[model samples]
Target: MQAVDHVTLATNNGAIGGGEVMLLRIAEALRELSVEVTVVAPATPGGVAEAAKKAGFETVQLHVKNRLSWMWQLRRWDAKHRKGVLWCNGLVPATATWGHRDRIVHLHQHPDGLHRVLSALSRVGAVATLVPSAHMLRSVPGARVMPNWTALMPRSERSPGPDAPFTVGFLGRLGPDKGVHVLAQAMRLLDEQDPGRYRLALAGEPVFVAKSKVEQVEQALAEVDALVDRVGWVRPSEFFDTIDLLVVPSVWEEPFGLVAAEAMSAQVPVVVSDAGALPEIVGSETGMVTPKGDAPALAEKIARIASGNEGVDVAVQHARWAENYSPTAGVVRVRELLDTLGA
Candidate 1:
């Protein structure tokens, strides 16, 4: 097949969330293959556009009045520049590029209600529909599964030694749905059983959420404040260096557990709740899984690991990450998918 001269990756969100991160990573991978790539996102706040530019990719910032404005702006943009594949990174972008024959609609989350309708609408006349996991494929029928992955983190020189504190860490947004509150509850349970035996470290800020939800998360964190260390908005690689284990106790059905993959890449053991694609990503051998929103079950799993009752081989987790969630593997799959589309 002949190589496509250029690919335009368009994002629905102005903010740099998991989907935007995936978009940038794919752009990097495609660029490595000598393919010309461009990123298009909203100008206001310009989070995705700015990050794309910082990463050395060409970027176009559309003057969107609001979310709805992107639909018309993207349509106008695509009408003028339809030379190569239009990769819609989410529902919004997919809607914007609707009915374009060279478009690929990629949905990073499970759809419901109106979003389900939008999901179907976004795929009309597209070359293909892509999702991050097999579980997500069930939600978006006929969509191809392309598992998410993370770049390998550099090893920390100040790695936790045997004498270091047994730290339990949480990453991602500080929201109840992401289950920061659930992790906080689990930490409280652990503290009740054996006070000062474990330390809870938290990274990330509350984002794209209501003020009430932020307050709810704060109230939950308050319950475990004495045992918590707030490490606000740091790189996952840096955050992983200070912790021995990572817990992703999300209450919602996550499309894919990117934090779990990042932790495993850092060679840290993980404990995930069986929500959405989390259990599917962690599998049975590499990490422990508990019922979603069950603080007691999560506490038990943490206690087992802390007290040496649960044998978690970090090397095995690292190997699993390398085989499945590594950037190399994800890039290869994306390359094959694009090849099939002749893009």
Candidate 2:
């Protein structure tokens, strides 16, 4: 509806990840600003396309078997019929449409190895390149920062009681990269020193993880199985309701910590490892931080958060800080990006 006339947003994967969540959020933001938004995604699994259509956007469902097929199909399809701004929402689509005109490349995670090679080629002939955090911008120096947002969560006063076990929540994939194994070790240490002092509300499953690593995590948690409530995948709102605090202990460099931000928005205390943007999301003033993969340090942080008073103070500052990453803030960011391109 603006100067660009139309905007076609493409997805990186058929299965939704943090990137897809951002893709959907930005699509809504685009529509709110009166931009014509059409989502391009693979037909199967169909998470991204379905969510977009449900939110009242036109969807171009590509008939494809795997990511490779989707890339080739989308690349061939766009060359013939593409118009207006083609917002390539991930490296897959960005590389697919490389050398094409008026393209915006958005990379959701830090590129490594083969992806680093592809990302270099993917940015050619694009209008702009975007990553989710300033932490990401360090590695991806040329890209602009577009922090991911959550639908502003309703604030709730939640904290562990005087006698109740302090409940810790983890809301990402149950893979080593998320530091789930590290958290399990921390829990074991917590139990060994101060028995029954903590409980973990594990709220994710192993997706896109190796079977060996998945088994490794299971074995790691086996010692404290009674203290863990393995709730599979859950929305942040639902996940936050069940715990006093949320921990994002990623071992790998994360592009953005959306779950940590959502925890802040919900007025729930959060702890993050010093990996990539996790620490950046919750600075010294807003949330807790621990050394990456250090069980003793993580356990000690959990041991320290034992009262409602500590939770109340941290949650208050966190909610205010989180305002910058809310959906409202996201709309403003998107508008600015659109306006810049429009100019």
Candidate 3:
């Protein structure tokens, strides 16, 4: 057996978003494979510390915010806990765990500038590096592509709501880079073409800033032709039930669009940008894909699905998701990687 005595997972677990959920799932999965998992995260808002205790894992909530504090914590970890493997979520923790080069580094984002420099350094020092897509592979040499997975909701719920104002749901953080402006533009375009046919549901929090950021997003929404219902940050369990069609118009090059996979698992059709890993997430046979930042194309596709002119088989879409991103397959792949690491 490989001498992986302990596994430390460092991530920003603020309990406000999906990253925390991903970290928890990964930790649980690793534990099931007989690895001693320890999650070292930022302190959460609620009783998550107690919850982690109930789940039978040790959690160290170091209240480290900025670079200087993080670096101090890293120096401390390096000095004390010198054995075991370290798997970090993103740049901050990855660099923090840099002193332990013999372990693996699984990078979640396609970093830029200084972060990119750190990632390259990690690649040179680590045993293996994991990324989510081919687009991300260009940023990190020899990085193995492993798509993100989720505990899927039932597929029957993917169908559009039969008795509502034709709803187009925009789910995900309402940050500037999340392409909320593009979604707003598309809603405007669609409302102009068919005033009574389409309505929008904006779900998730404004991650760009605090109170001012939400006000900015609200002001941006005012420019749109219609008013949208804003449902702030939702749990993964509650996602598919609240929407008809999930539209992800990401402006940036996302390493892996987990929203697409989440929607697909429910057998719902998605309208997403052609940028980054979106096309790979929502395969052509399953959902409608348009060019990045093209509001008109987004509107056109939304109109096609809303009007039922383009007969979208949501069941077929769910089948495509089942074929590829099932939790069973993901665990199997992870186990194989573990074996390879041992060998």
Candidate 4:
């Protein structure tokens, strides 16, 4: 509630995961609170780190490659800096101390052993976990669920014109698990039914190690690439302007699927797989959802939306997203945790 001196946010590289978005929001809100915020991490760039540097925050770079080394560096940083609150935005190492009782740890939906490791670290007594969805809270028990915040794009409110093509866009890492191929298969099916009824756009970068998979998909798409436009990564502000409907066809359970909320805020209807936070994030008002890994059902929903027959209320979706996940609301919850830290 009072003026806080400093906060340091450490997050994974956005080029790899979704944690950077949460970190960027926290940095912006804390900076607005007049806190001198500094970010420390590895050399990777984009997402929150890019946004933070643009907003004039100090960033320190360290070369801790794995979780073990990351923690060692974090402890050294915390010892030297001793800021108002040592905020661990994602996976990194930081030890417990009187100084960080109620220390803030923001979770961004990890999977496998990663989530287990982070959850165990969070339970080490000084950490107060901050996650973005109930599913995420359930994954990491006792973690507070806070909405992922965003500074809406200036053009996010611009309604798609009547003549604008019925476009559906998919965002996030393009992996088999993300169900990119499944979505593509659905698109191919729909294209056969009604040629040019809708245009599908696949945005976001391919996973780095997915070289072989990417080549395979590209070769497969050569058979019918015109049906889907595979646009690579773009800036954050540029993401919402190109689509009318967003689809997240994840085959696996996603922790928060912030893209669903992002689409909701942009007033774009969503169709996601009913896995993990996709169900929680994409309620009935926001969008229609299909069973995970079901391409035919996804195709059916896409056809319905493209036909403009589903009657999804865009106004209601936008209003709900703005109310629940606005930067103001997320920051308030974060600052409440900081208050418990004696900030």
Off by over 4 Å in 1: 1-3, 157-164
Number of backbone clashes in candidate 2: 0
lDDT of 4 by residue, 215-318 (tens): 76666556558877777887644766777778898877787777777777667677889888887876743458898888899999888877767878877766
How many residue pairs collide in each prediction? 0, 0, 0, 1
Q: Model 2: what TM-score?
A: 0.94
Enumerate residue pairs that collide in model 2.
none
Model 1, 1-343: lDDT tens digits are 3566688999979988889899998898889778899898899868899999999998988998888898888889888965588899999989877787788898998999999998998999988899999889878999999888899986575555675667999988888998888888888999889877889999988978789999999999899898999989998888988887899999998899999999889888898999999988888545598999999999999999988999998788888889988988887887888788874
Q: Is candidate 1 or candidate 4 better by lDDT?
A: 1
Looking at model 1, report the run of 10 residues with the lowest lDDT sum: 155-164
RMSDs, each prediction? 2.0, 2.1, 3.0, 3.6
**Clashing residue pairs in candidate 3 (N, C-alpha, C atoms within 3 angstroms):** none
Q: What is the lDDT of residue 214 in candidate 1?
A: 99
Task: Pick the winner on lDDT between candidates 2 and 3.
Answer: 2
How do the predictions measure up, each by TM-score?
A: 0.94, 0.94, 0.87, 0.84
Q: Rate the local accuracy (lDDT) of all candidates.
A: 0.87, 0.85, 0.72, 0.70
Model 4 error, position 314 (Å)? 0.7
lDDT score for residue 77 of model 2? 85
